[model samples]
Target: MEETRRPRLAWKIFKLFLVVLLVAFIAAAGGVAYVWNELQPPHKGEMVSFTIPAGTSSRDIADTLETKGIVKNGSFFWLYLKYKGEGARFQAGEYEMTPGMTLNEVIGKLNRGETVKEETIHFTVPEGYTLEQVAKKLEEQNAVSATAFLQLADKPPTALSEVLAGPLPTDNQVRHKLEGYLFPETYEMKKGSTAEDIMERMAEELKNKLSAIPDFDSRLKARGLTLHELLTVASLVEKESAVKEESPMIAGVIYNRLKAKMRLEIDATVQYALPEYKERLFEADLKTESPYNTYLHDGLPPGPIANPGLDSIEAALSPKDSKYLFYVTKKDGSRTHLFAETYEQHLKNIEESKKTAK
Candidate 1:
């Protein structure tokens, strides 16, 4: 009877131990379900705007999100980041978030830097614009002070020194040190960009454009022209060309004249020497006593007269193979030119051009 009592007591003790084990398992399962539910997106809140300052830590970001009601739990978000090994990949910027966004969505936006757009100002610098003209345009657009832009252009930024393919011309008569280096393009900058910033951006664009051309270095070398000279010739072509298709032919004419050691006698150079552009140039204008006046000078002008576009640059590098040394614009409103291999033929073409005016 004592042995029977011992077995029954043992069974009761074993059964009580099984019940405690079952209760612990149920409690553990409930705790896991609660945590998982808390981790999900709230999916019901207005959009919130925040800034993640530079060098902000992931934990701080998580806390900011929780405080803004973008997340249900900062600690859980922090843990999630750690689990995914992505805490260090967040970027700093102004962000807009809605609470409905999931954990993955929030993380993706931070990593991709989907920031709020700031106000920007855009201005276009057309091809063949002189440095002075560019400055004036900037002033008109209220982008930068014209005086400041000109002063900065006079002494170009040192950062641009590396971008140049050759040394900057030190000629006193070269109007501006950065005349032809600034590429012509529409640029967008922050509302308060400085003159140096704009100039540097334009110069860097020129460098990038040159780099994009196939075998540019070899083409420049084969032409036996320095970067400065190439720009000068390109500027000439740009000024002479009213028709884009005629640029290469005009470039060839300039090259032939240069090879023959003849004065360029370009009307554009004379116009550049004048204080302002004139619709019609006179003999006195051609006789202007400036180094930029190609009619008076023997070689390329002191420097490029204006910023040239890419087509003109390419024309200068690879001029059309022609013996033509002269061109006269047609008076027929077509903005085209007639080419000539001799002065006599040029005179005839000039007469023919005049006939079209009537």
Candidate 2:
């Protein structure tokens, strides 16, 4: 009886051991499956870019990665980093990521500092640049094809929405549909940006800048000028006043001539009518029959001749109090202009300018 009892006890002990081993194996298999799932890609093959700003915390990086769908679980990533003692290994830079990448691959890229470097181009539109000239400048930067830009200018896309509340010039003589709407400024654009995108950005900038002007609407109403008319006058002022200080004075001259029902006779207006810029306008050039020929028109031209800068736009809004009716660019290489209240004085300044030129 004692021997039989000993055999049963041993068999029972062996059965208990087998049961424990099976339980341990199942637990280990479950843990392995959980870890494999955690290491998988968050999504299918979709590439994305993210910028990790300086001094970002490990938890913050996890949150960003999760938000961008690059990681399956923020907590999992955090725990993995803590487990590997790699929480301090992440670098700050622009990083390109893909959903197809595993957690280890993502963390390895960040550890290796494999960041993406982007190229940008800067294009400056100077004050008083015509739409054509602006297009040419963009072409030089490879930002846009000049021909495509010009075509868009003629028939601007409806998607090219801007803050211009006023209608375009009704005069059939307007050269480009967006001649004076594109604000002049230096802009930094990413590589391979579209001409439409660049133009839209500039137009939005113009809207913002114009909105900041104090009492712009009241001043426009007081002067009986529409937004287009104001831009036209500003463009003229921009071209005529090389010296920024003379912007208001040139504006005054423009107003004086317009109020008197006299021809603007602005040289810049003639230049706009010409196919090409001319330092000197001949009698035949002035006779070119175009609505932009302010020398032949009685009042402001049909539309703006060029895109004006902030100073020129401000001068148009707040012209100086003066009786000046004429102005001529000085030839002393100072880019200064002589202002006069009488035609005789204007002729005298012209003569002086010629002498100074010699």
Candidate 3:
């Protein structure tokens, strides 16, 4: 009986030794693998972000991370994750990885499932640009292809009118295109974005700017302008005055023209007639017939030429009291206008400013 007890004790000791050896082997192997991985140079690809979806297997993730240069070896990464019982913890979404990222950093990114938003470049769409004008500006940056962005404007269905409402006519006619709606402001857009994307952002900016104004809707209505037409008129006022102080006065000039059934000979209106703005407005430029030339036609042009700012909008709303029929802007930032309850006095102011200019 004593001999039998000794054998049992020996057997128990042997089994403990085997267990210890196995644990030590595992620990050494893990340590060697970690050291080897650390010694390996990062073979990760260019610095760019990528997406990993949820429920991805270790093998698939390893492959994807490898493609993005997040991992040097897929098999090793997969094996490591499985051995550490981390396979089930791998989250998926978007992630940015770089050659500079350590294996540990890659693992952290995967476990956290970081989502990366696309980087975007920005440009400001200035106040007082028509869709055509806006498109041209965008073209200069190689952002979008054409001025066709204006074609998507809100209008009653004439080709584009079917798509969006265009400029609102003075007699309460709504347009099918979006001539007056794209708000002017800075925007961030992905490279190679479509004109549609560009237009949508502008429209969104327009909505944002409009929402901030008090009683904006009523003001638009009272002015007998839709949001689109109001923008058109506002753009005119914005371009006409460099000084904010004179916006209301210039607005009064615009109003006087409308009231007197006279032409608004604003240089800004002439500028809108052509795609390339001429530095000087000539008598010939005034006579040129485009939907935008206020000199050739009587009422506000079919639509706004440029996106107008709040200064212009306020001027449109709160036009100052003036009997002025017309006004000429001066180089010194001053202005001269023809005011007339009488025709004689109106002509006198024009001839006087012209002679003084000479």
Candidate 4:
């Protein structure tokens, strides 16, 4: 009877141990389910936009995600990131997310820097555009205020003055102080950029481009041309040459005319002097009183007639060696010019151009 009592007691102790094990398993499973649910998104909702500024910590990012309703629980998200060793790789930028997005999806977007597309103002300033033209283009694109741009260009910020090779022209006759200094190129700026910002950026680009040339300063000195004068010649070449290959030749003609003390008589300058551009310049138009009218002026214009491209600027710095001093457009759809050494020859070329006109 004592042995039978001992066996029953041992069976009862073993059953109590099994019951405790089952209860513990159920509690562990319940904790895991709760944690898994918390790790998921809060609920279905519209997309939300947020910014993670540079230098924001991972824990702060998790909190922001929670505050933005991107995740169910900030603490849980922080714990998950620690467990996965992730959040350290997240990037900072503008982000768009929906509450229904999975944890993995949010993590993936942040890690990959899949930010929302930022609005940018994209514009292209054509190679020969004047400061006014640039202002108009900026206004057309809604990139900046045209009036503000022109005003800033008139008296650019002090910081921009450092980029110039020398001081701006003191000649009041100069049409615009920053006319040819603004490098012509396609630009993409943030939507809210100010006029001064754009002008500085373009001027800096011009400085950088000039710095890239080999022996640029020595070359300018050898030509006996100041930075302002060089740009003037380059703008003339840019306006005159329809075919890019002819730029050097056109520059040479101008140089030769200058050496001979002959008038530049550039049509583009006359056009610039006019109230507006005209397809054809009559004798009356050539007589416009502005100093920019090379036909009326005895030497180079007060300043550049327009902004010029690198090729035109290079051509002005190093012109082709030529005896030719006059040129007339072919007008034969070839967009070329007939160069001549004498006025008589130039007259003949003019007749030839007329014959070839479409």
Per-residue lDDT of 39-91 in model 1, one digit per residue for the tens?
89987778899999999999999999998888899999999999999879899
lDDT of all predictions: 0.92, 0.87, 0.70, 0.92
Overlapping backbone residue pairs in candidate 4 total 0
lDDT of 3 by residue, 118-183 (tens): 767677777766667677778787787654554545432343222332333443332324556667
The candidates, ranked best first by lDDT, are 4, 1, 2, 3
Order the candidates by TM-score, highest first.
Answer: 1, 4, 2, 3
TM-score of each: 0.87, 0.73, 0.61, 0.80
Which 10-residue window of candidate 4 scores lowest in summed lDDT?
Answer: 160-169
- Tens digits of per-residue lDDT for model 4, 1-358: 9999999999999999899998899999999999988986777999899999989999999999999999989999999999999998899999999998988999999999999888888899999999999999999988898999999888877888877656788899987899999999999888899998898888888898899999999999999999999999999999999788999999999999999999999999998888888988898998889999888789999999999999999999999999999999897999899999999999999999999999
Model 3 off-target regions past 4 Å?
Answer: 1-93, 97-119, 147-176, 274-276, 333-358
Cα lDDT of model 2 overall?
0.87
Residue ranges of candidate 1 with Cα displaced over 4 Å: 40-47, 50-69, 78-93, 104-114, 162-166
For lDDT, candidate 3 versus 4, the one ahead is: 4
- Backbone clashes in candidate 1 total 0
Give the top-scoring candidate (TM-score). Answer: 1
